[model samples]
Each structure stands twice: as C-alpha cells, then as structure tokens.
Target: MTDLHRLSIREITEGLSQAKFSSRELTEHYLKRIATLDGRVQSFVTVTPEQALAQADAADAALKSGTAGILTGVPIAHKDIFCTSGIKTTAGSKMLENFISPYDATVVAKGKVAGLVTLGKVNMDEFAMGSTSESSYFGATKNPWALDHVPGGSSGGSAAAVAADLAPFATGTDTGGSIRQPASFCGLTGLKPTYGRVSRFGMIAYASSLDQGGPMARSAEDCAYLMNVMAGHDAKDSTSIEKEADDYVANLNATAVKGLRIGIPKQYFNVAGLDAEVKARVEESLKKLQEMGATLVEIDLNMTESYVPTYYLIAPAEASSNLSRYDGVRYGYRCENPVDLTDLYKRSRSEGFGAEVQRRILIGTYALSAGYYDAYYVKAQKVRRLIQQDFLKAFESVDVIAAPSAPTTAYKIGASLDPVEMYLGDIYTIAVNLAGLPAINAPVGFDQDNLPVGLQLIGNYWSESQLLSVVHQYQQATDWHTQRAAIAEEKA
Candidate 1:
C-alpha cells in the first residue's frame, strides 16, 4: 500500500471510497507519524488524538454509507490563529494561551462539516506579527527542509506540517506573506485568496484589512480541493463577500497556459538584495512558462517600491485597533494583583504579549497617534491605493503577474535578528496583500543549499481559480513540487 500520510486529498478520498483503507487507519497513521516526528519539527501546538479518532470513525461510517465528500476522512491541521471549539486557540501568544474557544472559527467549522478531521492546531508567529515563525510564544517551528533553518512566518507551523507530510494539508492565514513566504520556504504550494474571499470570523485579528485564511498543501490540485471547502460567503463575518463560491477544481485541467500573457514586474527582479541565483531560477521559470505557450511581458510597477513601508504602517495601524480587545477584563490573560485599572491593562498586556507583537503594537499605536496619523497612517493608505492602481494597470494587458515569492530560500534560525532585514524578506509578497488580490506560491527550483525557491503568481481580485489552474499546469511540467525533504525519506 502507498504511504497513507503522503497521499494527496484526492488520492485519500478515492482510497476511502473504494474501501482500500478505513478512515481510522489513515487518521491513525498520521497520528503516529505526528507523535514520532512533530517533536523534531515543532509544528503542532496541540495534538487532539481523541477528537481526531472520533471524527475519523464518523468519516469511516460516512464512506461506508456512500455519503462522502472529496475531503471525507482526510486529516488536516489548522493554524493556531483560527478558533476551534473546545480546542486551545493560542494565536502563538501568551495572551490567549489559556483561552478555549466556545465555537469554531467559520473556517474550522466549515472544514469539520466537509468531513475533514482535524489533526491538531499548529504553531504560528505570536499574533501573526513577524515574518519568521520564531516570534511564537510557544517557540519557533523549525523548517522541515533543514532543522536549523526557520520556517516562514505566521503560518510556519502549517507549512512545516504539510512539507514533512505530518498531515496531507493545513490551513494558514496570510496577512503579509504569512502563507506564501512559508510555502516558499518549506517547498509547498500555498494560496492567499482575495481579501474577504474567505470569512475572517473567529480568526484572531492581526491586520483586519490584510488578514486572510487559505490552504497550504503539497500540490496545486490538493490546495484547490481544500479551497473548495474553505471559500464561501458567511453572514457571520461582516468582511465576507456576498458572491457565490465557484468550483475551484472544475477548471483545473480544463485550462491551459497557451496564449496566457505573463507579466514580469521589473521592480521585482531588481530589488536591492535579491539573490542572483534566485533571480535566475525565476527567469528560468518564466522561460518554461513561455515554452508552454505563454508570452512574457516586462511591466513597470513603480508603486512596489513603497509596498514594504506602506504595509508596515497600515497593517500595524489596523492591528492596533483590532487587538485592543485583549484587555484584562476580557477572557484572555490577566495580570494578577493589579493595583488599579491602569495597572491591569499595562501589566496584562506587557506580560502576555511577546516582543515582536509588542513591537508592532507600539508602532501601530504611534502610527495612529494624533501627531503621526496623517504623516504615517493616512499617507500609507494613499500609497496602498497607488500600489493597487499599479497592479490594475499592469493587468490590463496581462493575464497574471509573476515574481519570486521571497528574495531567497529559507535562512538559518536567528540569522536575521534585525527587524528590517527580516521584514525585507517578504518584499515581493506584501504588496499583493495590501492590494487585496489573490496570489499563489509554487516551487520553481532549488537554491545552492538545495532549499526550495518559489515563484509567485498574482491575479486580480477573485481570480483564485485561474491562479490555481496556472500553478497546476506549471506543476505538470516541473518536478520541483515533487521533491521532498530528507526528513521524509529518513523516516521511511
């Protein structure tokens, strides 16, 4: 039999429907793998064996009764940021370390209804602030490719789990490259849907305007399956779009890149510190796409120069406003022996939040302050619009824009102590989030270290189906996504 843990969602579902194996057997296989390997990866914050086994049993029954969905009996992990009923949802912060959600986040609930079993809640950057997952209060999630290297931020845990085959796929949130950067770092396919394409209800707030939840998996086809279950309008979330969800998988193999106009953002190639080899790999990918019947066009997107600063300012400002609910009076962590209301607020926040989260909060508060609001926050909003306009103009003649997901591959843990250096790692991905467009990270090649290098495809708003199809076509022609880390081979 094939390695149950390594099979894709489509394969797993087909096997279950055919009675090749029970959902209990598949779920237990993943559970045992997680118990054995997650210690080394540090991917999961909580492992719910009891909950998972119960759900797997139900899935087995459903499969036997001929009532199964594509994801029935499949196991996946959720980023700790998403609220899960009766499960600890930490957001990788001490502030919510003890908090148990009474209701599942819309995404989690939806996945449960789809017959997908939750393996566990994975780790993330504390409050989703840092580009590296090291900022988590629970401790950093190590890159599965290289244990000494850092997994990309916020959604690192989910990325690590999928890359290591601890679970078939996982859910991740992309506020500022949280999904794509980690996917790039971990050698996985990840998608950040258009803002409001997926409900943000019960997702711990980071930057309300930029925060979005999406899927991380081994291949574009798997991600498309997960997206079908995850995307839709929900009245519970005010930010949720009212449009009907489309069948993301139906167009997977039906579309081709022939005559597809692929735009190359000139600014992306010439970024100050982009690795030469990484640039070469991106160019090679473009050439591959062109050979596959796509045309490449070099386009100028000058507003990209201002994306990093604009995003830092705007995201923090929104984060400042959204995270204000975690005060002492609320359900999160509270300081003991507070002398007064002021003391409680000050001590609770000071003690609960990590350095990175505190740093962003202070920066956000300052940006939104009376004296700096116009100079920083308001001006940043204007620049954000300019960036969006730049993309709009570029898309007029092109079907999609392509760029390197990150300037380089995964770096050693603690190698980037300077905040600016760490933040700059996401230079290519932040702009898409600022513009609230859909983007995907697909492995294009490997660096000198043999670490994965990914190229990003950015699409206009609500174009997730097109983006996934493009990625699927590219994967069909390349073997980059099929390469797994030595850890998987070592375990086998």
Candidate 2:
C-alpha cells in the first residue's frame, strides 16, 4: 500500500476489497497530502475533511459487508463547478462564493451512490470563463509540474489536485476545452463525452448547449472506470439524451486501433501561434500510432477559423441568459445598501463577477441585444452548423480526428495575455464542442520547456468508448501516461 497517492482508482478499489487498507486510511492519506501540498498548488476551493472521513467510514462498512461497488471507497476531488449537497458549489466566482447547493449534481450523486468518498471541491475559472484559472476569485491554481506555470482552466484546480496526488482522479467540465486544456497542461487524460452523453442537471450553466461534465484522470482506462459511473441519461436534465451508455471499462484492455482511420485536419498545423515543440510532439505521437497499424488520412476542415468567433458569440449569449438569475435579489453575492432595483442588479453583478465573466456577459448581452440578434448571434448559429457539418463530413472518411490539444503548453501564471489571445488557445478544441462531439486529451510527450503536450483525439457522437480504447492502446505503447510530476513523487 506504499505510494497510495499514486495508485489509480482501479488499484485503490482492488486494495480496498483485498483488505490492504481501509477507506478511511486512504481518505486520510489524500487529506493529509492536501494539507501539506495544496497551499503550494491552491487547487481546492474547499477541503471537506469532516464529511470526507464520515463518507470513508461508511464505505469501509459497505466493504466489510461485500456491498461495495467498483468505485467504492475511492477518493475523488470534484471541480467546484458541480453542485454538491451542503458543500460549497462555487464555480470559482465570488458570485457563488457563499452559496451551498441543497442537492448533489447528477455526476456527484452517481459517485456518492457508488460509495466514492468526497475529498473536497477543487478550483476553476469563474463561470468556466478562462484558460489559466487565473480568473478564479478564490485564486489561481499553480501547475504541480512547475509552480510558476498555470494548470490550465477552468478545470485547473481539478487538474492540479490530481497532478499533485491530492486525489486519485477528479471530475472536470468541458465548456470549450476547460477539462481537456487543463489536462493537457497538467499531463493527464481527460474526456469530453458526446454533448448529451453526460447529464447537465446540476452542473451550473455556463452555456447550456456547450457545457459538458467529464472525467480528468491519469490514464484512459482510469477515465473509462469513471465514465462507467459518470455517463448516462438523466430524466432531470432535458438536454441529457435518453441513451444507455456503454460499459466503458469492459472492452478497454482488448480494444485496438488497428485499421482505425485517423483524420489529420489540414488546418491543424497551420496556426500561426502554435508552438514548434508542441507541434513536434503531436506529430511524433501520430507517427507512433501509424506504426501501430492505424492509417492517417488528410482531411479538410475549412471551418476551423470560424470556431473561436462562433463559440464566443454563442457561449456568451447563453451565459448572459443563464447568469441573469444571480442578481442581488436571489441567492449568491449581494451588494449592501443598494439604492434601487437597478443599482442592486448593476452593482451586485459588477462586484460579484470577475473581469472575464463580466466581459463575456457584456459580449453576450450585446450579441443578443435588440436589432443585433440576427446579425451576430443568428449568424454565429449558422456558422456553428457549418462547423458541425464539417466534422460530420470528415467522419464519413475518418474514424477520429487527431490534433494538438492546445497551441502551446502551460504558460507562466499571470502572463496576462489579452482575452482574444487566451481564447485562441482553445482554437483546436472549441470546434469539437460546437459540433457536439466526443474528444479525448491524452499526454503524448513533453515540450522543450519540459511541460506536457497533449494529442487530442476527436471522435463522432457517442464515440467515447472508441476514443478511450484508442488512448488506452496508446498508453500501453508509451510510458508518457505513467509519468508523474516531481511533487507527486516526493515522499510523504
């Protein structure tokens, strides 16, 4: 049971069943690590030691009675974006800083049902709005690989915690690459299920259409185990498709990418700002897959340039609508001594939301404003369809599209890039969300800076199982997935 922090969920569950360690012991191990290391990483918004231990005790009782399920007694940290009953559900914003959810989100509820012990709530970009997690009102999450660098966001806290071994695996949400980009920066595997593959009932709305909850973990197989618990239709979420999810871990080990048609978008490498080392790592990964008998086919996605603009327009428009409820009148933050209703609304939102969130709200409000809806929002929707059609057409010739997860690896924290520059970092990933497709971000290799570079695999709708299978095969062939940050390797 040495190096308990380094074990995957599979290993932890097996050890628990074999009586190698009690769930409380493992829970305390992670809580201890969080106490020691999280000050340096700043990954969690709230660390629930009391409730976590209580849950661990319950899991131990279940194990003794042979009532434990696959995820029983496993410790997991959740991105603060997911609503947890009684636990603070801050989407890394001051707006919800004091708000506590009265019920568990579908994802959180499922983990609780499976006997998973809650470690705490990790940090994120406010309203899932930024790339560096710097926008969090709680504070920025530093990368465990290098403290000066960002962990990527708005799931940066989730990525940082897992990278630092504060938790085995954590949940992350992908709203235009929040999960995948952070996993890419932190050197882990993250999956964004097909649009409706996972329920959004309790996930706070950033963009109802594009925001999706997913798993961020060390390897694809680990993600598969989580997917088994996380993915499924929920009657509570109208957007959640009425589809039965496949047993993600069932065919994981035996799955192969032989004869898999991997699409290479012609525009993937043509980005002016894409780093050369990042490009080299992705290309090398593709070559390795080629040697594994997978065929590479060049495909055109001419709509690549429109992804950023269209997504910005659409996500903000929806965000403006979703966030309107956060005024001073209802739950969340409120300004004191407001003179009137107008002042209350204006001051509360202005003071509560971070600068990035404010910027998006303004942009969204303007896009949906009278007389401008069709010119901007409507046309963006049209472009979104074009983007979706591009992928649908590519799927006709290829099984999955492969590209660099981000244009660059983790940048130094507080680099202070402009909003547009930050938005461009997601250029390779936003298109998948616009098309409502499943994608995986897996660590392929390290860049010149020694930061991890990810190779993103884009698959057709409901192709999560196939994507995980391909990544699992890749992990088997390479040791990159096994690499841990130096902080994780440091002895307790």
Candidate 3:
C-alpha cells in the first residue's frame, strides 16, 4: 500500500474504518514529512507534533469502538491566523508573535470535535496584508515548486503545505484572493467560502467584510472533505449564518453540466496586465467545461476596473480598526523604552508592524479620519455594494462565473515591489469576496514556462457545494490537479 502521505482525507478515513492503517501511523508519517521538508519550504509556523499524536491516538481508539466521524483521524494544518487554545497563534506579525489564545477559533474547535488531527499552524503575510508570503515577519515561505519563486499570499503557506504534501490539506483565510491566488500558484484546489458561511470567532480579522476562511487541498474532492468539517454556524461569531450545514462531498460526482450557465466576464479577459498564456489556458478550461455540457455566456461586469482600488480602500480601512487592539499594553509585543503611555503606543506600533502593514494603517487612518470619511470610506462602501449588485444580477442569468484566478502563475520572489501592482494581481478574485460570494480556484493547465495556471469559478452566495461539484467534475476530466510540483514529487 502507498504511504498515507499520498492518500486524500477520504482515502485515509476509509482505510482507518477498515483498520488498514492506524491513525497514529498516518499522523507520524505527516509529522516526519514536515520535519524533513518544511525546513526548506517554511510553510508551518508551529508544528504541534505532541498534540497531533495525542489526537491520532484518541481517533484510533474511537475507530476501534465503532465511533468515528467522516474526517476522523485525518491530519490537517491550520493557517496561523486562526486562534487555537493553548497554542501560539501568530498572524505572521511581530505584534502577536508570542500571543497564545485561550480558546480555539470556531473552525478549529469544530475540526477537533470531528476527530481531525491538526498538524500545525501555517505561515502567512503579516496581518494578511500582502499578495506574496514575503510579508511574513517570521520569514518568506519558499515556493515548493520553484524555490526561487513565491507561493502566493496571504495563505501562501497553506497552499504550499498542501501542494508539497506536508499536510493532507490546510485551512486558509482569504481577504482579497489570498487563498485562491496561492492555490493557483501552488497547483492546488482552494475555495473561499461565502462570507459569514464559516464562523470567524477567533480568526484574526484582516478585513471584517472581506475576510473568509476555507479549505485548500490537492483536489476539489479533498477540499470538499475538509469543508464539510469547517463550514457551520457558531453563536460565537456574530456573522455566522444559521443555515443547516450540508455535506459538501456528497455532490462531487454530480457532473451534469448540461444547462449549466457559465458566464465569462469580458472585463476579466481584457485586463491589461493579464498574460497571454493564462488567458489561453482559461479559454481551454472553458472549452473543456463546454464539452462537459456547460454553456458559456458572455457577460459584462462593468465595475471590474474599480475592484482593486475599492478593495484597497475598504480592506485596509477595516484592517486598521481591527489591528488597533495590538498596543504594547495588550497580549503581544511590548516596547522596552516607554517614558509615558504616548511613547509606549508610538514605539510599540512603529517597531511591531512591517512596512506594508504600516502603510495600510496610515492609509486606513487617513481614509477614515474626519472630513475624508464620506469622500473615501463611504465611496468605497458604495462601490462594494455595486460589486455585490453586479454579481446578483449576473447570477440571475448564469449558474457560475469563470475567469483566470491570477493574471499569471507563481512569480519570482520580490517580482512585485509596488504595493499597487501586488494588489492588482487579485482583481478577478477580490470582487467575489466584496460581493460575499463563494469562489474556487482549480488548476486548468500550464503556461509556456510550465507553471500551472488556475481557473476561477464564482458561485452565488451559499453555493459552495455547487462550485465544489463543478470543480470536481473538471478534475475528473483533467489531470492538472493531480500534477505535482517536480520538487515536491522528488522530495516525496
């Protein structure tokens, strides 16, 4: 039998049910892989080897007693942004470097109750601010595929970990294409669930309205498996929807694309910076969907041009407010020199945050300041509403919207220096978040450089199952999702 590292959560669960493999053995395999390869990838911030083994033992006992859940004994990784009780939960920022949460985030708590073993905490951009993992305070996470290139951010570590087989799957928070972009670059399937679909009780807030947590894995079916555990309601999160949770994996075999309306937004195709190869690959994916009985429709999302600027304004504005809790007096980092309270606040923040974080804080402060509120913040909110309205109208006529997840594939480290240029990479994905819609990124093909390209699928609010079904159908017909990074395969 193949090692547990090559099997999906579903496969591992089935094997565990039949007593073919002990949960402890599966957990040990992954822990050993992380210890061997993670040094080069730096995907994890904290590896909970002891906790994972303990949970695996408990899961093994449960299976022996005929008491096991769907995800029982599966090894998974959590993004550092999600808080875990008694575990160091750093949002990849110096501000919360040593902060330990007293309670688990709703997602973590739910995964634990479902009997899943947590591998560790994956790294991310500081406060989930950048498009590349380079913004991490700990260190930049090297792309497992090409060490010189970056696995996209702020969920770069999550994507890289799953792509590299460091973990079976990982959880990630997407504010503006964080999960999808990284998944695309890493050749994995990632879903940014509809806003408010998953509880955010202990997810360090990046942008209150845009931040969302979801699953990233080697395939769409694996993503669905993890989503089944992560998606649900929690009274702790005010924004959590009260709708009954559905089994996401139940519909993965539904390949009935007949009569499915797939909208091709013209604005996404015409973006100035989009690479020709990416466009060609997405078009090929569209052709494949059409062959599967999907009908492609041309649609216009006229407000697309303003997505980047509007997102920059709204996300940072909310981020500034959310990050204000990190003063020296609180849980995280404290400055040594402080003659008075004012000096304490200034020095603490000045030394704690990175350049990009500070820039956003300043921009957010300026935008929300007196006199500028109506001009900047209010206008951005209005634009956000318009983006949502556009999606609503489009969905009335189409089942899904498709586009390139990112303008290109994994870029070289430090390829994008200007913050604006980095933000523009998420143009196609941020709008879906702003509209509170579910979106997934699935590998479609490779570019001229052999880097993987991803196709973005956007579904209406609460339509994650539908999106997952479509992606699973596509993966069944294509080999892109199964294609591993050369370095990863070599290491395996």
Query: In model 2, what is the error at residue 238, expressed in angstroms?
Result: 0.3
What is residue 400's positional error in candidate 2, in angstroms? 0.5
For all candidates in order, the CA lDDT equals: 0.91, 0.93, 0.90
lDDT of 2 at 130: 92
Q: What's the distance in Å from true for residue 475, model 3? A: 0.9
Whole-model lDDT for model 2 versus the true structure? 0.93
Tens digits of per-residue lDDT for model 3 on 1-492? 435677877788899999899999989888988998888899999999999999999999999998888788999999999999989999999998999999999999999999999999999999999888999999999888888889999999999898888899999999889999999999899999999899888999989988999999989899998889889888988899999877889878664677799999998899999999999999999999999899999998989988988988898899889889888996789899799999999999999999999999889988999999999999999999998898899988999999999998889987755877888888888998889899999998888777889999999988898999998988889999888876566443
Give a tens-digit lDDT track for model 1, residues 1-492.
548876777888888889999989988898988998888999999999999999999999988888888789999999999999999999999999989999999999999999999999999999998877999999989999999998888799999999998999999999989999999999999999999999999998999999999999999999999999999999999989999887988978766799999999888899998999889998999999999999999999988779889998998888889888888896899999999999999999999989888888899999999999999999999999999999999999899999999998888998846988888887999999999999999998888888888899999999999999999999999989989897765453
Runs in model 2 with CA error above 4 Å? none
Model 2, 347-418: lDDT tens per residue?
999999989999999999999999999999999999999999999999999999999999999999989698
State in Å the error of residue 398, model 1.
Answer: 0.5
Query: Positional deviation of 58 in candidate 1, in angstroms?
Result: 0.4
Give the TM-scores of the predictions, in the order they appear: 0.99, 0.99, 0.98
Which window of ten consecutive residues has the lowest lDDT sum in model 1? 483-492
